[model samples]
Target chain A: MNELEKRLLDGFQRGFPLTERPFAEIARQLNAEEDQVIGALEGLSESGIISRVGAAFAPGGIGASTLAALAAPPERLEEIAELVNGFEEVNHNYEREHRLNLWFVITAPDRDGVDRVIAEISRRSGLEVLDLPMLESYRLNLGFDLQWS
Target chain B: MNGIPAIDHMDRQIVLATQEGLPLTARPYHAVAKRVGLEPQEVIVRMRRLLDQGVIRRIGVIPNHYALGYLGNGMAVWDVADESVLEMGRMIGDLDYVSHCYLRPRFPPEWPYNLFAMVHGHDRGQVLERVDKINAVMDEDARAHDVLFSTRILKKTGLRLPT
Candidate 1:
């Protein structure tokens, strides 16, 4: 990516604007036309530079989100991934290289519901649910420049 | 995502309009556009600019922590050996269980843990066990680390532009 693309990513991640003509405003700032700005973003999303274009909320603020994992064998990895991602409560899931194996975050309507969901998963998958809830938050910021030097 | 340009008031309106959650209905962008008093395409155009510039990282659902029953959540830091951290970090992050994992600059005197990952479990025991599993994958004499769990959630918002 060129310097301009890198700069745009940095600005988006750092401080996103909220406005009616937000793109037009951004175009004015970047000295680009609104159409150009829109087109570039479409291209960016198409190029897999970003996953999506929307809001990211804190799970607990509205409901509850937990970090849950299962020790799925190699044979059942795909099956497990499908099962875990099936639930509406399950938002993000990934494969980590740990003994625990499959790792996923479950978001629910309430904190108590997390336990029920885990129990249901445990029953279906027959995998022990190791639940780790957040006890304290020292530094919770996850914003970083995509092209930080 | 890369980076977006520093935004202005107009951009702030667009962001605020879509901040809470995008309507799941058809033409979700239309509602956002109407609220902002701009054409749907114009709103789309502006959203594109923000995405192009990396103004918005992603538009997705953020799990509710309290509702999830993951009462225990914390930033678990590890004192990983330099050689293994790069691989270890990726491995840990790859886990479907771990929501986030990354290497952060650690201060010697103040912050001892350079590698940080957010671990969420139903309880402290489960969280510790998960940490233990991650630790077992590391070198025997790897640097020590600690977990800074959140006792109370002060504030939780994705990204806020200067209004």
Candidate 2:
């Protein structure tokens, strides 16, 4: 990463300006041109370095969500995973290494919607779903320093 | 769990407008405010208030770990004693490698892990090393632990409110 890229990653993780011409504000702070700053951000997003430039809502603050797991038979894991991923509510689905290998996050506008999705997944996959909603959050922030090696 | 405070219609509109992302423009907030039919100044003020109220965690770039070359990410779950779990969780969460740490409910018979800390590293070995360090920190309080490395991402999307 070059100096400009490093600065972009470090400075913009949080506290991005909330104003008209926000990119211009960033450019002023970094002593770079407005277009350069915008171009760099565009490049970063295009390269998938940053998912998006937006707000991250607190869990359960804006909508209902739950972490669910399923113990799919190894032979049928792929098929069952595809079935589980078919739900729009299932935003994050991952294949982990465990008996309860197929873990996913179901988010909805309300608690009832979350439960409905879980039930549908259970019925469709023919597997028992272990719904583990977050009881307490010690730390939920995902921003971190990008250590350039 | 605390009751969720009801958000007003305007707040809902603001969230809906920015749920995907702020527009990439010289005047992004103005663009969003325009779409939501609110003044740019009002949009900024509302966003600031939302941040203060913990409704909006942060307003910034959300980095993709996998794209940043942190390929090995493990959801390390631990069977820590309930009495010391919170303190242990705080300690684990303070580690730089641990991004998200939460106390989630554990199911009996099949699932016993209650504490979860997401560990990220450049490779599988690095992730395991971090897990070992976490285990060492927990010491005897951690009865058992397991690291479930994600093999594939079936679906990944940001949280979005129903429109």
Candidate 3:
């Protein structure tokens, strides 16, 4: 990719626009047209450089949320992943390199739902879970600017 | 200055498109377009605007923290002499394994943890060892350092673009 493409990719990682005709608005600033902006983002996604272009909600702003993980055997990794992914509340899941190999985040309409989902995962996957709720939020902003970097 | 920044529906669509389908190939834009129903060029331009406005930060892959084998994830909070907090923040943020570092508004009697920095390692022992390394480099008068190892993670996603 060219330098311009790199810059574009870097920019999108922070956040996406939350307005009508957001692409056109972005185009107005980037010195490019709406079509060009849209195309570039699509290319970025195809390239594996940027994961996705969407809104990342502030924790607890949307609903109840919790970070949970499981200690699963290698043989059952696939099955466990499927079970966790089945829940709509399960947004992100990763196989971290730890005794807690299966890590995921679940958000629901309320605290009760969050608890119920965890219980379901335990029953179906047959793995013990470690649920970590946010005790204190210190500095929660994850926005990063690439042009500055 | 008055408003955080106002956005529109198209802008929201772009964010949704990217989040839903992150390209994993050489031509990410083309890949995203197929999913979002837009051309590669359009995606590129919109991203640039988001960057300029400081809405989007950088676009990069977040390596699986565990995949890198730095499994010991802990939030180390410190009560430093207010005078040296800024200097110390820079020092801590510079750590190779410290993915996030910052100072937040302090609420006394209820919240005392300040000067938060996230460090990860392969195990508790490794994480603790690094914490020791951090402590060793500290200047005098920095007190009450504590590590809150994340017992679990609830949600880890990018910022929600105003929609």
Candidate 4:
């Protein structure tokens, strides 16, 4: 990555300008033109170094969400993952290295929605769904501290 | 997201529009406003409200952890005493390498863990070391703990706005 790109990735994780022209504001900080900053950001985004330039919501602050898991046999892993992801509510699903391997997150407009999805998945998969809802959060995402070295 | 005040139709539009992310442009909000069929000022106001309300934690660049070389990702789960979960969670969260720490429900007789901390490192060895530090912190108060490394990221489509 180029120097400007490094700074863009490193420095702009948080506190992105909320002004009328945010790119221009970023440009001033990085000593680049507005279009150049925008172009660099676009390149970073396309390259998949950055996911997006937007808001990170507070989990369960708007809609109810729960971190859920299911243990799928090796043969049924893909099928079960598909089944879980089939719901619009299942946002993140991961194959963790454990017996209870299929970990996922479900978000819905309300507690009932979240519970219904979990119950449905549990019923369909025939595997026990672990509904591990957050009791308390110990950390706030201030943005990852990307190490350049 | 918890404690969401009733969002109007327009605010919901703005959330859905930006949920994927904002447009990469000189006037990204303007672009979002136009697409969502609202004026730029209104979009800005709504977004500001969302941020202030904690519905939107922060408005900024979201980086991919894997792309950023955080290869060692593990969800370390500890079966700790219920009374001390908050204290233990705070202790774990204070660690630099631990990205997230939370007290989650445990499914006993099968899964027995309450405290979950997401530890990130450039590789597994580093992650293990960090997990070891967590073990050291709790000592015997942690009845048992296990680090479930992510073998594969099957899906990571982040948070979805409830439709």
Model 3 CA deviation exceeding 4 Å by range: A12-19, A145-149, B1-163
Give the distance in Å from residue B2's predicted Cα in candidate 1 to where it truly belongs. 30
Whole-model Cα lDDT of every candidate shown, in order: 0.60, 0.86, 0.61, 0.86
TM-score of each: 0.54, 0.95, 0.53, 0.96
lDDT of 2 by residue, B1-163 (tens): 3554656789889988998788788889989889999999999999998888788878888888999899999999999899999899889888888888989998997899899999999999999999998888789999989999999888888765654
Error of 3 at B90 (Å): 11
Arranged by DockQ with the best first, the candidates are 4, 2, 3, 1
Tens-digit lDDT track of model 3 for B17-131: 6654444344556665666678778777776666555444444433335433455777676777777777787787766667667665444533454576877677788788888
Docking class of 3: incorrect
- Chain B TM-scores across candidates: 0.78, 0.94, 0.77, 0.92
**For candidate 3, lDDT tens digit of each residue in A74-147?**
88878787778777778767666555677677777467888999999988877777666553343334543232
Ten contiguous residues with the weakest lDDT in model 1 chain A: A140-149
Q: For residue A106, what is the lDDT in candidate 2?
A: 86
Mind giving the per-residue lDDT tens digits that candidate 1 earns over A1-149? 55555556656543344454555666677888777766666655556564334565433433456766677887987887788767766655656554556656776646777888799889999888767554322332334322132
Candidate 1, which segments miss by more than 4 Å at Cα?
A: A140-142, B1-30, B33-163
Q: Ten-residue segment with the worst summed lDDT in candidate 3 chain A?
A: A140-149
Q: What's the distance in Å from true for residue A135, model 2?
A: 1.0
